[model samples]
Target chain A: MTDDDLDLDLDLGPETPPVTPRARPTTREAPKSGVPSAKVMAERKPGVLSRVGSSVSGQLSHISRPNWSFRNFLIVLAVLVSLVVLAENWAAVRISFLGLRLELPKALAFLLNIILGGALTWFWLRRGVAAREE
Target chain B: MADPGGAWHRLLSLLQAISQRGLWATVPFALLVNSSITVLTLTIEPDGSAHRQISVVAAPYFRDQVPGWTRDVRADADWDMAWAVNREDDFVYNRDARIAALPESGEAAALTISDVAQNPFSLYTTYRWHEVVGYSYLYDSDPAAAEATNKSLIYEITMPGTVTNATVTPATGSSTKTEGPKVVFELAASQGQQTIEVEASRLRWGYLLVLAYLAAYVIYCSACTLRHWLRIQPRKI
Candidate 1:
């Protein structure tokens, strides 16, 4: 009642608990490969090709990592092939066989092959993933 | 149910792990099968009513070169005649008829048979021995069918042959005329060859196409199985 003069002794007849120190927010150390920060390099100067090369190499290294999946490779292959086919702009390309021939548009052929590849990939994934999951 | 995301990742992993040989094999295999399919559909004349469905036995009989037959056309080397008959009377009953010898000069090929079928319109008839081979008597029995334009009928194997170069005359009576034997028209090696020899053989073009596809599919299946087999082996590298 009087600034805890009388109550302090009454409430705490025993030892008082020590106050706990507040923890600091921890910061993570930068990775060793940091030659120069991207912002600093951009501000300093960056050649067009060098920038492109670095970006591309970064992607390539990422893809080449051991944990990369086969399905991703197939999808990339399909995409690249489809793009090339579309860019060629051929109409009704013909393939000949023993006294026979069929013509199909380039885009149609690429799309069809992609669909087939995707379906096969999906089937393979189902079996392997399901077993591993189990 | 556990996670589709995990399943897809596993699949991508499998695809990337496929061997280089497996990848290489797919290229040629696809090329072969796809090309063969294209050729087969594009070449063969679609089956039509004008197609003379003579039994293989009857086909030889009608050709008049049947060995030891009384009416052996081969033996009558000098015989050159032309005759026409109606469908119900001649073609239905008398399977064999004498056709004139092909003219020796002025043209390289002869017209043999011309039959027309219009539904998706296919005409499957042969030109043999210097004549166009078709349903010989149909023209007489079915005059209205004759007017049908697409009716399959063998009109005549012309005496003088037709000459076809790079320039083709479409719908022209004389330009695309089917000549006697294919030997006379193109493959000179076939000239003077016996009908039996030709009958026993297959078209080289068609045969080659089929074999290509067969080989491709076989390799593809083999490669597919081999990949699985190789996976079981202990890593050597």
Candidate 2:
């Protein structure tokens, strides 16, 4: 219970040094091939026109190689025939439709063609995805 | 899940499934519907002629001076009456009718009847009169040229039935004569107003059959597509 006993009880381990923060890396390591790092390239914004052009080109590339099938052929034939008939009897057909009459026959016909073609394309894509899964 | 873009994606996928299952059936339906509409809109025949009557007042010089005044009265039954007056005129004096822009004046005029359906035997009549300024040198020397040059009016009428008692006013030529389906009347030295009359018969039973068949086919194909689409199971996300 003397001073020596008190010092022995209080003693724990050897004094540890104060920890210092690690220094920030001064310069980024150069890319091995001399190309900009992915982080740096991604940080740069693309021009509006270039972005739009890339997206359009991507869609066109996707559409260029449609899977050929009987259903696709029939859909294409039906669309072509509808377009031809619309072209030949534009005046008569324009007047014939009740409430859906349009001023520009070619425009209306093209709109209809787009809707039909889009629907068919969607169907083809869905079927292809399903078949691949199976 | 409540986002608008998510909802749009779901709706699009649903449509995709429906269309994929029913595309085969829908193709024939589309073809039938388009063909039916084309046939109904363009080729359906009318019950009667458009019946356009046009009278051109003869100029003072042309009143009685033209010897063969009625020689150019051409009657074409096969010609489309709707486009009769719109056609190009063959004669120089009759060319005025062919111009659509110029106002109705001088030797030409036109009458149009809209919404009138086309017919197979619709009669188209054009009255053109040319002056007979004596006979040419070859015909001047021959007496037959004088007889031939004498003012003559010709009526060429076409109809299915036999043209019985067909006649023209101030008649001085041969009686009503039948040539196949046409009735021709030649009159000598005529002046003033003249009238020609004949009866026609038309066949009218095939159109209904065609329309009915088209309707039935469209309905059948549409029903099949609908049934197939309804039976399809919704795709799992």
Candidate 3:
């Protein structure tokens, strides 16, 4: 049908729905503690110490929080203590492994075990994040 | 499930405490247990009153005694009845043999045993004295300190006379060595038996015989010295 042939039924037929205004979220005030804006902050990589501290903290919070599972908490703690023990035994000695004997410092062993602790820490973090999601 | 006071539960609790408190949590226990190692040394006197010297490893048993000195040392002190009576001398610290330096430290202290009942405790009798020289403080005469300890104890007892016989109750892994008047009974930690019993007797005449022999040897040496001096002297002088 042509535009001129169509009847003008703006008021005669059913009422036309009004268009909803576009809503804009208001800007939040700057935090008093001087926290950087999430969008503005650079996505720089965390140092080794920072990553280790975060993992340890996450594992401990899992231990101390009221709803923490005992087995996981204990496993995490065991990982932490083993790491510390490895660090403390930073001395050179003859280490026999699978019939092959070699001399190495315990600190080297500690460096090798650090990754193991980090892995456990990551597991705890993933589990915690999953629980939170649930 | 393990009991709350059971070893497993206790270990879990300790781990929990360490997790809560960090590394500093262990420092107090180490300082209290490892630093003040208690060694009981008992030497029988001529009059038969056992002379006791309780020596303790220095405050820095694990660490350096001085700034640069790393030798493990136990400091000895004269016995004071007042100190023990006040309960200031009942510390239960003992050397952990696992610490490699302990065996080489050469810190052997003599602890006195007053538990032998004086009534039947005569040197003339050939009977055995089953002294409970472990942590049982029954013979310590301090009725208030009646707790049993689990630490390994080394008993270095000197008999006033010759040892007729010597034995340790837990003879397995336990060493009992007698050198004349002195008897050394070492109870290792792995033995797990807290009670270490020793059998000792005195030879009243042996002391006199030793003293007489020493005197005769001294006299003979003096006579030889005099003869040599006379022979070396100038005749005109």
Candidate 4:
């Protein structure tokens, strides 16, 4: 019933009449200021797709999605670059060491030098570990 | 909470790290234990027949006497580095006590099986893997070759013809060398023996016959084009 329709007068009332609350606060058990982080987490579950979607939507609010046809273009470009680099070093280079003639592609020679250096370093390190353990 | 397997896992991780970073440190005579792997060499014949020679430490690098894989299974002679193959599963030898410096020498063995049914010449490619009977991890069915991680598992395959492509699956620090028909794939034993897929083809009668048909077809097409170019339209039907 509306408050205006509840107008009544009692004739003989010994004690104080019943007192009714006019209005109650709608928010209960909640802090007076803002929502808590824990409550926000409890309200929803976070998934991988949801996180990605949220990130995308936040940044590209009005931008359109990228085309799908060029998805593998970067991989193809990387392969092409590798092939070009290999081709660039394909010219035969000669080196004379210890009265022996060694001829190989520039790439191969560099690779061999790197391998030899790595082997030497590994051997030295192994020796050091052995001695240290002993 | 304490886990029983955690200790074992930690020990294994330490050993693995040591093996990768430096020389082996489990045994006292780690340096004496030769850092050599069991080399398996397969010489594929022109007529689709194949032979594999597997050589282990202190074992005879089985001198292939017969064209069909004849071997002397004698471990008495100090095995020089060569291909040694033991086709049978019952092939087991006594481990040399001097190598490991252990009180008692355990048993050592090797077994190799090839899928010759998929002939390279017929299929244009073939897949083969070595099931080197392993130890150390005895509880598990040691189907793969179990050796020192620092050492290499070498597979030298002499194909029938020039090898077009040779790739090892599950690459773990693997390297391949292709010299004409011979393809040598060296992989870390830690990764286990990987399947070797080789694509090779020999110049045979079947290929020559197919090429002859292609050549005729090309010539006929070109000749027709030439006739049309000359405006010789007399022949109909």
Maximum-TM-score candidate? 4
Q: Model 4 off-target regions past 4 Å?
A: A1-134, B1-37, B57-149, B205-237
Clashing pairs in model 3? B38-B93, B40-B110, B40-B111, B41-B109, B41-B110, B41-B111, B42-B110, B42-B111
Clashing pairs in 2: B67-B151
Off by over 4 Å in 3: A1-134, B1-38, B46-48, B59-128, B135-152, B190-193, B201-237
**Per-residue accuracy of model 1 over A1-98 as CA lDDT, tens digit each:** 59777888778787777889953433443357975333222234578998999999998986745432456545655665555446433344444578
Enumerate residue pairs that collide in model 4: B53-B84, B54-B84, B54-B85, B55-B84
Sorted by lDDT (best first), the order is 4, 3, 2, 1
In order of appearance, the predictions have TM-scores of 0.17, 0.22, 0.27, 0.28
Whole-model Cα lDDT of every candidate shown, in order: 0.32, 0.36, 0.44, 0.46
Candidates arranged by TM-score, highest first: 4, 3, 2, 1
Report the lDDT tens digits of candidate 4 across residue range A59-132.
89877764423334445445655554555445445465775656566668777888999999999999999999
Question: Residue by residue across B1-237, what tens digits does model 4's lDDT show?
Answer: 666684565456344433432221111111112323445565655433334455443223322222111122222122222333454432222211111111111222111212233342352433232222111221132223334435565668776667777787566667889998899987554453244566665444443444455566568668778988889656567
Residue lDDT tens for model 2, A1-134: 79998888668646677888964443566588987554434334689998999999998887767644447656755665565445433321222255443344444656688999999999999999999999
- Best candidate, lDDT-wise? 4
What DockQ does each prediction reach against the true complex?
Answer: 0.01, 0.01, 0.00, 0.00
Which lDDT value does model 3 have at B193?
A: 29
**For residue B192, what is the lDDT in candidate 4?**
31
lDDT of 1 at A48: 93
- Give lDDT: candidate 1, residue B106: 20
